[model samples]
Target: MARRDFPRRSDPERSPAPREREPGQTSFLGRWLRRLLVWGTALTLLAAMALAVAVFVTERSLPSYERMKSTQTGQTIVVRASDGSEIVTLGPSYGRWVPYERIPQTLKDAILSVEDRRFEDHWGVDPVGIARSVWVRIQYGQWRQGASTITQQLARNIFLNNSRTFDRKIREALLALAIERKFTKDQVLELYLNKVYFGGGAYGVDSAARKFFGHSGEQLSLAEASIIAGLVKAPSHYSPTADPDAAVKRAKTVLGTMVRANKLTPAESAAVDLKGVKFASEQGQNSARYFTDWVLPQLDLVLPDNDQPIEVWTTLEPAAQHAATDAIQANVPKGAQGALVSLDRDGAVLAMIGGTDYVTSNYNRAVNAVRQPGSAWKLFVYLAALEAGYTPDAKVKDEPVTIDGWSPRNSGGTYAGEIDVRSAFAYSKNTVAAQLGNEVGFGAVANMARRFGITTPINTMPAMVLGSSNVRVIDMVRAFAAVSAKGSAITPYGIRKITSTEGEVLYSHRPDPVQQLVPNYVAAGITDLLQSAVSIGTGRAAQIGRPVAGKTGTTSSNKDGWFLGFSSGITTGVWMGRDDARPVPGLQGGTAPARAFAAFMKIATAKRPPERFDTEVKLPQWQLEPDDESMQANPDGYFYADPDGNIIEPGAQGRTPSADSVVPSGEQGVPVPEGAPAAAGDDFLNRATGRQNEPPRPKPKPSQSPKPN
Candidate 1:
């Protein structure tokens, strides 16, 4: 109240005044702290809301519990033999589902011990386990542990696709949480056991148990359960069927895990012996591997653009397949390869052996390998000649011949002089065939081959008459099947019918109306000639105590051997060769190939009765005339008739001269007598007279020839 009453204590030793804070410094700190607190609370709330929204969206996106529970598994594609016997199961095969109550306790314990020991205690996502896994990964510089629990696996398998990405992982986690919320722990376990993939196309635990042990999941032993539990990590690698030792080692690891998890006592774990555990036998599994492999690709053709599982009923006869395989493996020379394909009269593939061992090589020689048919190619040549109005009994000059500088000689390097076309074909006379090719024109021969279903290119060269072009065994079989089917056109097929798992018909092979690919007389004539080949000539080794018709083929340098034959019921082709094209010393088509053919055909046709070929045409009688130059060199000379029914020399009465009375001409290469037929130069005369003496027909339009090997 008194302005001057109090002493001036302010100036008297004022305690050191607190240093004045920088202008607005305290306010700045306060303002910053307040702003930080507000922002933190707002951000925390926003983050919490965002997390809830994400969780809600994820929950909405997940498949419903009922939908997941009712999901149909990916079924197996079953390939069956013609007899309806199981051949092989194609993936992804879901086996019979096992309920939770039906599952073996040992299996569940083993799975829990190894897959997710904390399955019962943890939430859908185990943070502790994840932390441990991350620490372990960081320590090892690689992923050593997976924290995925059974519920998570079930979630991924059921509701999510198999993609290793952050988004997928998040979705998987969310789905796992939802699954746990909706289903009990037992339900999740049951679903996981029923949906997990095992090796050998097995999907569920039941299938795995059966696939490995040939038993039910409920009947699993401790060792069996442990082994099956071990396969969840890498099914193929740890499958007992594929690798028993690795599987045993994995099972032992599983046992140790069980002991550590207190699911099994140490003594009990040690007592589990994998030695007594019998794995499913592989003999049956591999029995049809080769066949299934050949047929697997055909499924797509039968059911194009189909992703659903199906049943393929093939044309394979198990017995026939076994017989063919055995015959090839037994008769084929060591170090050489062989193939056999058998077809029915309607061109259904009965059996096929692509190689000696499919595991060693998967190159399907029967379907893929194109090799020179050698004399087997002569079938087409003879067929062409028959179609050109030449009879099998028509005589062909089997002497040395040259066409465009290509001279073809007989296989034995000896000529039969003048022989019937039947004999020429039976003996595999290259010179006679070349002459026939020249007379009929290689273009006609090529056309004839095309008519018989030979897709390989045919050149106009005379060498093609001796099978200079390569042809597949399947094509050759189809050609022979046409002959066996009495000139019916053939389209070889393997798949007979295809059906979806639900028994819906996808494809069924309805045979086309039979149209003659060749004249009946022509087919009959070829059959007669080929029958002679098997009975008394080059193909005799293929004789199976029944009426059989076939041709033997040996390539140049004996590099390839082949026998294409057919019975009234089945047609088969056999090929033997080295992969490197190296000549097999002393190998002949009439030897190994014929024997193999016989071996398989005998079994293939055992149930069928022997039947003669269709009625053969009666060829008109023809006599060679005196003017025929070929007869001038006839060593058997008593007057021989040429293929044209012309007498080489006339008797005093102009009647046909008797073989006993006609004198042999001592001269060699003598000039033709007056009015004698020119040496294979007159096309009109050759065609009209039905004689194999004309030059090659004018080279037709040049077609694309198959590339030579």
Candidate 2:
């Protein structure tokens, strides 16, 4: 109260003036600013610590650069076709290492022009390229350009997989930086040239030059260099062997890029002869990979182990291999898989196709898969009958007959009452086959298959007369090859010779003493039966304007289809079915399998001289009998003959053998099942699905997302 009197009552509007702050003291506003400074300092320190930790983590996951710098796997296997052309490489294939100075300037410039223009100026990553790529991504909202330098690509190929992820990007950047710090510009370029993968299994610039241009990398011409450079962008899409037009176009783009980069003059670039870049006539063609894969595992058995690279000369004929590949690709059904094996009379494997494409599947189905030969199994059954002195003219009852427990049915419900052995075979009469099996004894038939070099376990079940036992595709090929070889026992072989990289012969195939499995007269009789079948029977679809003796087999419920035969001294066996052994609806051996055989045979036999099959055993008069009413009704309906005389036997073609052969009669509304399991007393080869001793198919690798080219 006294202070209020002494100090004149201050007006509410007039307050005491604020005192000035002391040297060490702060006003309320200053104190707030000091608190903000402390917080900002703490945040800065934390950010610094976080960056340090991130860098430490990234560096720890770096790839072993030292190991990648040198490419030496101790041993590599290079497979060559019969004509001395490379088919495939089993391990990493690197060309003789050439120093940076030895590499062609043209190749160097072309690579730099397309892959990385500032390769010499940048450390490991190009800041300008990264900035440009970022700008393009911003403008287009997609990754249309790549910022990876030559060093980055080298790191990626050597150390990491093609995984598109944020982690991969960071790892690539960090690794690129490390590569720049460790290697000189010339060393980096040399490593990039020596370690990059070219299309068609070529691993280095030198290998690619030799593979595509048939020359050394040091001798690469401008056009060849440009072609090789373009292939690095997208190997498969721009390979000259895969697509010549696309390769030429890509080469031209590389030349244009070179001109812009000042690495090449416009006139020089224009004068570059892209057409003059000649590639090896057959340089690891995609189809030949199957043959190479088959021959790879046999190296250990043929030659002693060594650290040097090996050169395996295989018996594979490139032309025949290509024909088989094209045939399977053209004729195989959408969901079905087909395998083919072709062998010469001497048991030399000429061609083998495991799947439609080697890139799609590498199961080696031709060598590893064991399936019921279907009616094709009749080869052994008939052989047993002939050995038992049954002539082709011998008559067998074709009327429906039931054995003790099972009765096998013909492909068609109706059958001729009385037919000769040849006619029965041609019509694929189930009753006659079962009777022959009983007459000859199932034990004899099993022994016959075993003598033919079939390694699969074969039991003496009466159903085996109709091909019930599982057999490997190569075994089927070998058995048929024996027929082509005049009934001589022989082992199917793909490797002809093996050599060391230093030009030393490691192994050379020497003919083994020929062993007779079946008598020549018996083989001739079997050939006559098979010939009649092809001439006017179920195998008519396999006719290729020349003598072709083969048998068709379709498993019960259409689970498998097969056509195994010999033409022009070449025995080729075809198997079509699902990998899971599931039934293929409407699939018959006379359909797609036979047609594929014909298509492949036409090309395979184009150069080989045609030879007549042994016809010592004459066919019965019934072999040439005219088509009955049922056959006439379904003449063109089964396997379908085109107007041009081409047999277009697809998976949906026939429900019966068709043509003049046994046909389904209207009276028998229920069609007979093929290769059905026969009861104890009666049987043809049941040919039920059996896959014994077959290696499991390899699981397909997951495909990486397509990246910007």
Candidate 3:
């Protein structure tokens, strides 16, 4: 068979014979190379088809070019106080639109260094970055390397939702290509700088600069720019306000990267440190968030429902907000809640503290919580009496009285028999308030309250005269604001102007015609009564030397302590109580509430021009003679005397309020006379606190530092 192998091949039906080894035939390795090339070519065709299918599917899901071009950034609602300071921002907070040329070159370089070093060289989708990110992901995990270019991020932010899926990533890549084709590199960079989000409810590099460094992006220092650049990686993780140590650490990394990228010299980076950067503390920024929250809902009433960016200018005063927060933090007792609301004569809210710490409880006591006002409600009762032709010196019996089977007792369970109207109001005599309500008619008092802006339900019961009816702190503040406005009807408001970022006025608060809630003379009469209350009565602790008028109120069982005062065209109301209405021990209106009012007004009115209450009306002297019958054997006799003709409450003995109205010495806004005795004025506070003859000293903090926002 072997000898006939060639002849066997000639037989067509037989199997082919084994061929002899031919000369110069291919080797085994060559065969293997051929097989590998064929298989590799087939795999390359299949992969190309897969990529084409992926691109097709992703492009179909992508937003239209027109949609992407017309896509507007999120509508930002920037709310600022009247002083042009930001209180809060609703939705996305955008800063001033900056052109590419205006973008800080250092910031741009830092961003490029940290975000994508080949940003200028890439055409939206970077092959090198994608390969590296893929390798990193394979070694580590997905999301470990974003591999997003500047244009890619812009595309994702502007055109895509934040869905971390492979499909969305493909769509983002397609959108980035489209963006790069439609826009220039410089334009893409500009949009990214203006659209990126920094932590703390701020968006854009400009806002981030202003937020962290208190300057515009154009004014960013190299250090500040580096810090902001680092935030783009993880805003919440590296924010200056959120994690200062992390922020500084990340910023140093950015500087190092910049040096390596040839964008910054090592010496230049070494010369810059954030040590004295002075992260501009908006001293009263968070303190006024309550007012911002209040004004936010009202924007719906004024603005159209379109998604256009807008700016809201509110009536909040930065100084007033700081003062209110400082006072409440200083005087409000531990385990108790406190709130304060201050308004200008035009009914514009200057400041509002919803609680001791907004971080703890955002339940706004100023506008939401309804509670008994105690004697503070007497503001309406006495106002009604004045409207009924009662004078400040008019006599009203302080003897026991009953109405509708509800008999209210005086603070100390005893009342001076037939005191003048001023004395009765100053002493907070419940009996006198009862009699005045009876004479004025409870309905009339309720009408007066309504006229002064109290919208809560009120009853005609006699106890209502002693603040038995529940009301909001804002109601009391508005009523007092009416008095400060010389009896003009005051409608409490916070928003002063609403405008577009383009400077178009959308809404402006128009000054309404002054509607008289009470005659000017009646207002003056009530002012006299309130002034006496602050100077000598239960509200003695609320005196701040300048012409001040106020009233103090203490609910039954000491469940609530309140003080409402006005000075220099500003009216402020303070309330302290437990959220559950449980009694706060020894919490009288004269204790902490009045002290907060005094301290707040002292700082709030410091920059305001000195003002005085008009007291030209001819009337009987408010100062009582020594032979006054009410002073003898009275319940408030020895425990309450101001030696200077003012009456102090027994509970508030030794610490008399500033009796004399002293002019500001123009030094630090303190009203202490330059040549006066050291132990004469505020020295009384020193004596009570065991630091007699010394200047007013700041009290020690009562609790641990507040939680971070």
Candidate 4:
């Protein structure tokens, strides 16, 4: 058939089906796809293995488990008043590493019922809880339930950043597993309960129980335990002091949960009543808030370590503090504000009241407010005169005298012509003090005040002779205490002792007073003068039936009034005025302020015997022997005259003591009689330059210069 094929239709001129592809090229796309699939699978498997290793290592090496049973060294400071009552609390460290079994069952049940219900079953993770939390958040459009298991919360609190991130969550999950592996369920629960924050600066369930319920964690009833547990979520919001109603509501919710969880008996549920949550006022519970504040900064600087809590024994007397506060509130005249500070002679703070009400105004008038001290400032003037060897009975001219064009008049606008230093100080005579301040070097007075702990900057002006310089009651009180301490000036101290929780004393505060100012005799002299002032002087209102020394001060226009007094063992300073530096209509140092001082003193010393000055004091004898050249009166005893109609120059020997009185050693050379002028050769300048002559420079003005208000 092939011979004639050309003509046959079926014979097949076969174009030979399109050529088949080569073996390698036939399924190239399929091979490529298979290879890519295999490699992807292998890479994913390797990555998963690495992740597991990393997580396992992290879980095994969590730092918290290493420190799970560790305790922090807390400091407990005890502040005791002079009467031995606790008055201030510093950092107090209290922590006991208790095992889970020993922990109160109520505390455990309360915590479990409120914080995490499935705490025992979860292996550091709860998928159902996470899902439920997520759903709740989604439904509520806010973070409602955290879904954090006990382990998770512990992980976060112990060693995680306060943030919400996937990375943090992953880390938390890994750490939680490690914690569970390292500790028993009870241990983990115990640590969680003891380390959780319970607000009010309380860091654990025990502290929270004490602060909120005034009971120990071990002694908490079911209701109290539940309330404490509820505080873990939002302490501030549920704090009794912040919102007692909210706290009660939260407690009731916790109780309900406990009842549902079978942790509470039916009878317990019926008996549980959370309506009696008592909250202490957060403001000024210490009572010596001002004194405490003043002492803390100094304590921080002197404390051996800052991290540990300290027990500071203070000098505050609660009864005295209360009395001072009551007196301020009861006696402060209308339109007047005031401060009262009481301190031990050794500079220990006893009672400090800053204002009429500590809660309303925390301005700390005792330590912060600086107002003019009217006549109270006169003490430094008197002190300066005493230091210069002048007796308290030294005579000072009370007549008006112009110094540098400044005229000082007596406070009541009348002068006692001539007066002794004792009488001058008793009367609070501004003119006499001004003359004394000018007589002694003005700088001397300022220096003496500085040495006595008057820290406020003082100007060397004559007005400071009267209590014109501004001073704080605290500083003034401390200065006055120096006098009672027999010239020893001690820095004010409020802390007594600081200790560790283990009863190891960290520090003890003993007074560190120094004697750099006036001598004891000089202080005694000044104190005597002040005592006289209290007896019959301007400070009569402050008199107790005991020996006392003090000064009274009234600022210009009666804006500020002050009465500072001291007995043998205590010193107190009081100030009355408006905070705005405005005048208080009729307020004066001898009125309300003085009365308060007296009232407080009466109560403060009710149990103590009166104290006496510990030094011998004698009245000083004064003799003025004017030389012939310096005598003003003539032979007629009333007609001494010179070209200027003033006292003429008298020789040193021209003046003599009265024949009736025996002259002392230094005065024996005096010969001039009153109204007699010195002979030609007996020059007053020569007498001033002779053996009895004065120093090259005139004595500087008084020890303290007065400042204008």
* lDDT score, candidate 2, position 604: 90
Best by TM-score: 4
In candidate 2, residue 514 scores what lDDT?
Answer: 80
- Can you write out model 1's per-residue Cα lDDT over 1-709, one digit (the tens) per residue? 7567766566547678688777756677889999999999999999878866766776676666456644655646877789976667776765556778999999999999999999998768899889999999999999899989888898887767888899999878877776777678998898888788878778778868867887778899999999999999999999898899999999999999999999999999989889899998753533256566777787666677776667888898989988998899899988999999899988788888888887778778888888999899999888877765677787778899767788877766898898898888888888988777776677878888888888877777778888889999989999998888888888888788988655678899999887777657778899989998998899989998889999999998989999999986799999999989899886789999999999999999999999888748654333222122211111232433446433333232333334333322353345544444322324433543577665545434435222211
lDDT of 3: 0.79
What would the per-residue lDDT of candidate 3 be over residues 254-371, giving only the tens digit for each residue? 9999999999898998988866566766444456777777888887887769577789998888877888899998988888999999988888888899998776677788899999
Candidate 4 runs further than 4 Å off: 1-52, 59-61, 64-102, 131-146, 276-287, 308-313, 357-361, 393-398, 417-419, 500-504, 513-516, 618-709
Candidate 3, run of 10 with poorest lDDT: 626-635
Better of 1 and 2 by TM-score: 1
Candidate 3 is scored at a TM of 0.73
TM-score of each: 0.69, 0.59, 0.73, 0.75
Better of 1 and 2 by lDDT: 1
Q: Give the TM-score of candidate 4.
A: 0.75
* RMSD after CA superposition, every candidate: 11.8, 20.1, 19.1, 10.0
| Candidate 3 regions with alpha-carbon error over 4 angstroms | 1-75, 131-147, 162-164, 198-200, 252-261, 264-286, 304-306, 402-408, 413-415, 615-709
In the range 211-275, model 2's lDDT, one tens digit per residue, is 77777888988888889999999999998778988999999999999999999898898888887
